[model samples]
Target: MQDDLVRRAVEDGDQDAIRAFLADICSLTDMGFAAVARVTEDRWIACQVLDKIEFGLTPGGELAVATTICNEIREHGHAVVFDDASAEPDWRTHPIPILYGFKSYASFPIFLSNGDFYGTLCAIDPARRRIATPQVIATLRAYAAQIATLLEVRSPPTA
Candidate 1:
C-alpha cells in the first residue's frame, strides 16, 4: 500500500514543485536533508529527498516505521521538532536521534485533501538548528498542504 503511494508521489506530475519545496526548505532551515516520506502502518519510504549531508537515503528508500518520528507525527497529528537532540534532556536518549546521529530534526505530517493521511515532510541535520517557531511551523504546514493537494489532484482516493 505504501509502495503504491510512494510510487505515485515520486512520479506525480508536480514532482518538480515538490522537489523545489524540499530544496527551499533545506535552504531556509539550514537543514542538510529534507524528504517527503510515505508513512504506512509499519513502514516509512522516501518518496522525495533533498540530501546535502549525505544521510544516504534515496527516493524509494525504506526505513522501519518504528525507527522514525514520522510515525509518531502521523499518529498524533503534530509536528515533532528538536532544536538539538543532543542538548535536549528529554530527547537526548531518544532512539531516533541516537540511531540516526542527528542533533536537530523536525517532521510535519502530510494529509490528502480528503483528510486521508499521506506521509510527512521531514528534515534533519547534524548541527543544532533552531526551528519550531511559529513562522517555521506555518511554512512547513503550508508546504505539506501544497504537497497534499498535488497528490490529491494527481490521484484521489479510490472510491
Candidate 2:
C-alpha cells in the first residue's frame, strides 16, 4: 500500500542514522518527543519516533491530518516554533498546543532534493523550553536537511 511505501522510504535508509537524528534532536532540544512524520494532503504518518515521555506513537502510527500543526507546515512550507505556547497570544487560541499539553514545540519542513515536500522533523515537550534560539533552530534545520537527503537517496527517481 502507499502507507507502507512511505514507511519503507524512511526505514529502508540508514535507519540507525534516522534514529540518531531523532535522539539527538530530542536531547539537544531537551524535549520528550521527537519524530519524522510523513505529512501528505490527507494523512500524517509517523515514519520514526523517539518518545521519552510516552506520547504513545510509534513508526507507522497515524495522527489525524487536520489536527496537527505539521499539516499547516505542509501548506505554508515554514517552520513552527515556540518556547511557551501558553505565553504566545497566537498559540493561546491555537488548539494543538492546548490539546496536546505541550508548551514547547517545533516542526521544520523537510524538502527532498527534488523539491518535493516530504514531511517534518519535529519535537514537543510538556514543559517550557528554550528551543526558539537561533542556534537551536539552525541545528534543527540542519537535521531536517539531512533527513531529506537520506530519504532522497533511497527514493526512486522521478519520471
Candidate 3:
C-alpha cells in the first residue's frame, strides 16, 4: 500500500512524490511547507524540500538548521509545528529560520527500526501557519517513517 509507493519513490529518488504525499496529506488537514532532512552523527542534511524552502552556508560556513534540529531531535525526538518564532521560546534566538525566510515550522525525528536516528522530516512556511489538528501531525509522522526507511536502505553497510 503506502509502503510500496514510498519504496518506489525512494528507488526513483522521486522527491516530488514525497513532497506531494506530504502536501496532499497536509492539505486535508491544512498544513503547509512539508520537507525532509537527513541527519548524520555530527550534522543534519537538508535532502528534500516540499515547499517554500531555502538553505545555504551560514556566515560561519556550516550547515544551517542541521545543528539546531539535530540537538532538538536528540533531546525531544520531535518538534511540533509552531505558528511563529515568538511562540518558540528557545528558537526565538536561533538564526537558522530567520536568516532563511522560514517563519513557522514542524519536524519529526527520523529513526531506524534499530533505534538509530538519521535526521528529520519537517514542514516550514514563510508566514505563521496554524496546525491544530492531530491528523496533520499523524501525517507528518507517517512521512517521517518513510524517510527513516529510505535512510536505512540507502546508508552504507557497517562493518
Q: Pick the candidate with the highest lDDT.
A: 2
> Would you list the rank order by lDDT, best first?
2, 1, 3
Residue pair clashes in candidate 1: none
Superposition error at 50 for model 1 (Å): 0.3
Q: Against the hidden reference, what TM-scores do the models get?
A: 0.91, 0.93, 0.66
User: Deviation in angstroms for 115 in model 1?
Assistant: 1.3
Query: Which lDDT tens digits does candidate 2 get at residues 1-159?
Result: 555756674464437889999989988989999999988999888888899989988887888989999999999999999999999998977999888889999999999876888888899999999999999999999999998887777774364
lDDT of 2: 0.87
- Between the candidate structures 1 and 2, which one is better when assessed by lDDT? 2
Q: What lDDT would candidate 1 get against the real structure?
A: 0.85
Tell me the tens digit of each residue's lDDT in model 1 across 1-159: 445756765665348888899999998899999998988888788888999999998887888899999998889988888789988887898888999999989889898766778899999999999876888888988988898887677778654
Q: lDDT per prediction?
A: 0.85, 0.87, 0.58
In candidate 3, which residue pairs clash?
39-118
Q: Is candidate 1 or candidate 3 better by lDDT?
A: 1
lDDT of 1 at 158: 59
For candidate 3, write residues 14-47 as lDDT tens digits: 4455556667645754444555555555544445
Off by over 4 Å in 1: 1-6
Q: How does model 1 score by TM-score? A: 0.91
* TM-score ranking of the models: 2, 1, 3
* Residue range with the least summed lDDT across 10 consecutive positions in model 1: 5-14
